[model samples]
Target: MTLDCFCGGVRVTTVKKPEFLHACNCDLCRKSGARWGYFDPSEAAIDGQTSSYRRHDKPEPAVDVHFCPKCGSTTHFRLTERAASTFGDTMMGVNMALSDQADLVGVELRYPDGMAWSGEGAFGYTRESRILGPDG
Candidate 1:
């Protein structure tokens, strides 16, 4: 699948299927405005100019989040090692927010543990799960 930023500056084309899909509650994630679809290292082909941000001092080498260089829209993310594993491959993470037909993706939202923020009142686990599906 191919994911493009709202403004179409950054685009990620991956052949690997996402290992898991979830909605993160970390403050950074919330700020970036992304719903994550975590893929295995081997299943992704990421391109475009993605800037990095290391907030909250994550011990895991910096999560390289990519954004649209032209419009400043957050696009995608990958672990340093995971990005390296692709070595020019293709992967997919359809950003629901920007997707014209996001509902077709059938992605269920999941709560990833260890986030810096919480969705206490924003949403509930069961509600999100039902929307995202069992794989989320």
Candidate 2:
């Protein structure tokens, strides 16, 4: 699947279809309004220029959320060393809203309460569709 940012400044191409898509209800996610498809950076080719942001309070390792500066659209996110160690590989949260070629059938769609992730791991997640997974 190939995705283009609102301003066409960012582009991402996935070698294979994503297995999981997430709809998170956290402060950042809620405001951004993007459903995310998760994949290892190795699974996709992400090209383009984007601006990044990260919360300072209790930040996620070196995770950086990136967006198209021109369109102000959230495009993707990348994790740093710490998150990579815990999560196995560096994963990118590709914004599904930006892509028109994504094939989501049978893919697991998840609703996670990112606002209250207990660290014991998502105790408040619901498998909303055939599309969200931890298989990443």
Q: In candidate 1, what are the lDDT values of residues 4-104, reduced to their tens digit? A: 77666676665643444656666676677777776654665556676655455555433566677678887766556644564443433434354444432
Candidate 2 residue runs with Cα over 4 Å from true position: 59-62, 85-88, 130-136
Local accuracy of candidate 2 as per-residue lDDT tens digits, 76-113: 88886687788767678888867663355557677887
Predicted structure 2, TM vs. truth? 0.80
The whole-model lDDT of each prediction reads 0.56, 0.75
